[model samples]
Target: MPVTDITTDPQSLTMTLTAEFPAPVERVWKAFTDPSQLERFWGPPGWPATFGDIDLTVGARVQYRMTSPRGERSSGSWEFLSIDEPRSFEVIDSFVTDDGEPLDGFPAMRMTFEFHETPEGARLVNTTYFDNADALEQVVAMGAIEGSRMAMAQLDAVLQDLREYAEGKGTRVELLDDTHVRITRLVNGPRELVWRAHHEPDLIRQWMLGPDGWEMTECVATTTVGESYRNSWAPVGDAEGEPFGFEGEVLLVDAPRRAVTTERMQGMPTETLNDLNLYEEDGATLVTVLIEYPDKETRDMILATGMADGMESSFQRLEREVLTAARP
Candidate 1:
C-alpha cells in the first residue's frame, strides 16, 4: 500500500495519515480537485461515492453520497475553508441529509491536505481534526480508518493508470550500442535557445539545480572545441560537507547543432562520453543525448542506480525554467 503511516492523537483529537504516490504533484492535485476523478477512489471498497456540487474555492460547499451494498446510503458535505493550489487545502467536513441538510448531533471535523515533492514522486499528508475526543471516537467507530485505507489504495491504482498513459506519450530512452544509451526529447524552444541554455554558465545555474534545496555553487562553462567546463553544487542550508561536482573536456563543438564531451564526476570511478545533438523541427528543438560508458556492465550498473529519474527531472526543470523564458 502507498500509505506509510497513520496515527491518532487522542489528546489533540486528530488523526494524521501520510501516503506516498509515484506521480507528480500536479497530477495528484488534479485527482483531488476534479470531481470525476475523485469519484473513482473517494470511498471504501464495495461502496463508491458519487460527488456533486463541487466548488473548490474557499467558502464553497461540496456534496457527495455513498451507498452500501445493502441499499443503505450516507451523504456528506464539505465547506472549503482554504485552498492553496497544488500544495494544500483545508475543509470542514460534516454528515448531511440527501437534500443537503446537516445531520443533527453528528460528527464534524476539520480536514487538511498537504502535498510535498519527494525524490520518488510526491507525498500527501492528511490530517483530520475533531472538536473533541468524543467526536474523534465517533468517526472511528464508523469505520473511518479502514475506509480511508481502502480509498487510498484505490488512489494508488488510479495513479498507476495515469503513469502508464503518460509513458505511452512521453520522451523516449533507448540503448544504441553496447556502450551507448540514447535519450531523446522534443523540447519547447528553438535550437539556439536550447544551445545557449546548455553552454552559458548563468543559464545552466538556473535550471541545473540538484533537487529542490540544492543550488549550483559554481559554474564554469567553456564551449570551445578543446576547452573544458566544471560545475559544483551544494545544499543551500548547510556548507559542511564536500560539494558534489563534475568536470568535462569538450571534444567537439558545432555551435547550436552538436557537441561531444568527456565527463567525470568527483566520486564516480568511470569517465563517460556525452554527445548532445540539437535539431530544429517546426520552430522547436529536438534534443538527443548519447552517453557512452566504458562497457555494457558499467552502463548497466549506472542505470541500476536510478540515474534516469534524476536526469528526467533535470530535463523538466530545464524546460520549465529555461525554455519557457526563451520561447518566442
Candidate 2:
C-alpha cells in the first residue's frame, strides 16, 4: 500500500509531515536561510540539484530549473515572507513551469514550515491546505506519500553533507523528513545591451536551447501572459529526448524588469508553471529563473541535474552573443 500523510476531514483535506534531524537547532536554521546551504539539501531521492538566480531573503525571490534523472526539467517560484533566522519561515509556492502551458489545473499552495527544538536535534513540520475533499483525495491518491519518503531520503544526504562540511569534521547526523517536489543563472553586457537581448526574439533564440543538441527549432510566442505559444525541437546525436518537445505558454510578463512567468512542458510537453526575471546590477544585468514541478519525483530529478550550472552556461553564451551583437 502507498503511504500518504493526508487525512480526510469534513470540508477540506490536510497533510502534515514531521521529521527529526540529528543536528543542533542553530545549524539547521542556517541551512534553511543560506541559499548555498539550502541548495545542497533541496531535492528528493536520486536527484541532486541545479539552482538558478538564487537570492533568498524576506520578499526576495529566486528561480530554479531542475532536471530529473530521466532528463526532464521542471521549474517553480519561492516568494519569501517571514524570516526568523533559522527557526521558521513561510512562503507561497507555485508549482508552475515557465510555460502556463496546461496539466489539468493546480492552484498555488500556501505552506507554513515550522521548526521545533528537540533534545537530540530538531523537528521539521510541513503543513499544506487543500481546497476541497476531492482535491485532497485526488492528490493523495497520486503517490504523494511515497514521493515524500524519497524526498526525505535525499534530505538525509544533504544533512550528511552539512555535517561533513559546515559542522566540520565533528558531527554525526541523519535527517528524515518528507515533502513534495515544489521546485540559477547569470548574464553579462551593459544595461542597454542586456535589455535589447531580452526584447529581441532573435537574440533570445541564441541561448535558450536545451542540453547540447536540443534546439527550439520552432516557437510561436505572441507576447505577454494569457497568450499561448508552442515550440518544437529535435535532439542531436544519439540522445533520445523526452517523449514530447512542444511547449512554453506565457503566464506573466514584467517588461520593465524584463521578467516573465510561464507554463512549460517537462523540458518536453506537460504543463509546468514557472517564472523568469532579468535584473540590472551595477552595469550588467542578471537574469534569474524559477520553475515549479507538479510532483516530488519530477522536482527531484530537475534539482539533482545541475540545472543552475546549465542555465549559467546558457547565460554565458547569451552574454557573449550580446557583446558580439551590440553596436560595435
Candidate 3:
C-alpha cells in the first residue's frame, strides 16, 4: 500500500517504483541496510527471504533466497556499486544460481534506491535500468512489476515497528540454514570503537570475556588477510570451566566495516567460517556475525552449548566496561 506509482519506460529501458513511508529517512534506510529488517519485507507475501554473506559496503556481494509457499525457491544476489549512507545506494541485481553465479539467460540490471525526507515522512524512489528494451520487457512479462509491488506493500509494517524489532534486543541468533547461523547485537558504541575493540589485543581482553572471573591469558590478534590469530581464556580464583581457546586465519578484511575468518577450537581439525560485519547508525553500532558450520550436526551442537547466552554476556560487558569508558 505504500507504493504510489510504478512505471516502465521502454525508451529509457527502465522500471521505477515510488513509495512513501510514515518514518524518517534514517529508519527507512536501516530497514534496507540491516539484513534482519531487509529480509522481513524483501520477498513477496508468502515468499519470505533469507539473506547470507551480507556486507553492505561497496564492492561487496550479498546473496539471498526467497522461498514460496509450496517450497519452491528462487535465488538472487546484489553486487554493491555505491553507497551514500541514509540517502542512496546502487547495486547490480541479478537472478543467481545456488552457487551464487548469475543464471544463464537472465540479464542483470542496475538498481538505485534513493531516500528523501518528505513533509509526510519519507519517500523512496527505486529505479532499475535494464540493458535494453527487450530486457525490460522480459522482466515485466515475468511479473517483475507485480512482484515488486507486493514486496514494497509489506514495507509499511516493517517501518512502523522497526524500533521494537531492534531496540533492547540483546545478542540474538537466527539459524539461517542447516549450516549457517547469524548472531546480531546492537552495541552502544560507534563502529570504529567496536572494530578496534575486536582487533586491539589490549582492548579485546577487557570485554571479549564471556563471564566474570574469566581472564584472557593469551590474545594474539591479527588483521592481516593471510595472518592467523589465537585467543585463550582461563577461569580464575575458583571459577569453574577449563581453559579453552580459538584459532583462525583471516580470509577477508575491510577495516572498520567487515572481516571474515576461518575459526576452530584449538587442536580441532574442523573449522567454521566467521563473517563479521559492523554498521553504525546514530552512534550505535550493529554487530552481525555470520557463522558457517561444517554441517548440521556441528551447528546443532554449538547452539546447544548456550552460545548466544554467553555472547550476550560478553556484549553487555563490552558496552558497560569498554565502550562506556571510551566515550567522552
TM-score winner among the candidates? 3
Local accuracy of candidate 1 as per-residue lDDT tens digits, 248-274? 888867687667788888767679888
lDDT of 2 at 68: 49
Q: Provide TM-scores for the models.
A: 0.50, 0.44, 0.60
- Each model's lDDT comes to 0.79, 0.54, 0.85
Model 3 misses residue 60 by how many Å?
21
| Tens-digit lDDT string for candidate 2 (1-328) | 1122434353546677677778777766766655554554455532334455545578876655444433355655667777776678777666666653323465555566778888878777767667676766765776656556555544443454422332212112121223222212334456556655555567667865645666667656555656666655667678666534445555444464433444555355545555443444445444434455667666666556665554555566675665656646
RMSD for all candidates, in order, please. Answer: 19.8, 12.5, 10.0
TM-score of 3: 0.60
Candidate 3 residue-wise lDDT, 1-328, digit = tens: 7999999998888899999998899999998988877876798654567788578799999999876533467999999999999999999999999999889998899999999999989999999999998889889998888888878976764676433546698888877568878787888888999999999998999888887889999999998988999999999999999999999899877688767888999998989988787767667887878788989999999889878987888999999989999978
- The reply for model 2, stretches above 4 Å from the true place, is 1-12, 99-104, 161-328
